[model samples]
Target: MNIRQDDPAAPHVSGLLAFHLEELRGVMGEHAFALDASGLSSPDVTFWTAWREDELAGFAALKHLGAGLGEVKSMRAAPSARGSGVGRALMDHVIAEARQRGYRELYLETGTAPLHEPAIGLYRRSGFVNCAAFADYQPSPHNQFMVLAL
Candidate 1:
């Protein structure tokens, strides 16, 4: 698989992103969608897309938060691409990008439900540790926060 920073507005990327949002809505409800800023135009944010040969494999984003901080957002592995290392590769790309941008820390938010276990495991294995809520997030039973010092 190959991963590269890409435009989210591309046709295939946009469709898969919609699919990701639908999946999130089904599992986490509308409140889960509240923090999404994927559709907005922001100079501080960048989107990455993963591909296997010609197929779109997955996508994730990094949002710059200044002060040597960065946030991970909209990470999604295509259902067909799960377990084939798409998520891991995307994460590796994000981490390297954050470091290249001079970020001293990287943070992310995922859910606490069983459905999120795989992702949490991935983050943990990638050197992230559990942490209190940061940025604009509030404490909530359904949310799990994590941070990694770069």
Candidate 2:
């Protein structure tokens, strides 16, 4: 899969954020989405979608934490694309871009649910270690944090 910057007009990005907005809320509830630590709307944040052939498979975003740290945001793979390595491809793309841009480490906060284990595992196998929440995030019973060196 290939990763590309999100284009608001693209069928992928056009509705993708709206979809994740709802899903994220469902996963973490209203309080967390309001934080937007995910930075989905920040102009400085980078949104990328994975594409294979002519189809968009999944999406991920990187949010700058302003201390050589980065956060993973909006990581989701299409139902048909799950378990097919689409999520990993998106993650690898973001990690490579982060390294290229000199980010010293990457971090993320995800829901503590069985549905999230695969994503957590993906990060673990990619070299990330469990960590306390970074940036402005406070500890949450619903969320788990992780970090990785660049």
Winning model by lDDT: 1
Compose the digit string of candidate 1's lDDT tens values, residues 4-48.
Answer: 778777777767877877777777774463224445236788888
Model 2, residue 139: distance off in Å is: 0.9
Q: How does candidate 1 score on lDDT? A: 0.84
Off by over 4 Å in 2: 8-10, 34-41
Q: What's the TM-score of each model vs. the native?
A: 0.92, 0.86
The 10-residue segment of model 2 with minimum total lDDT is: 30-39
Candidate 2, 69-93: lDDT as tens digits: 7887778887668899998888888
Q: Local error of candidate 2 at 68, Å?
A: 1.6
Which residue pairs show backbone clashes in model 1?
none
Number of backbone collisions per candidate = 0, 0
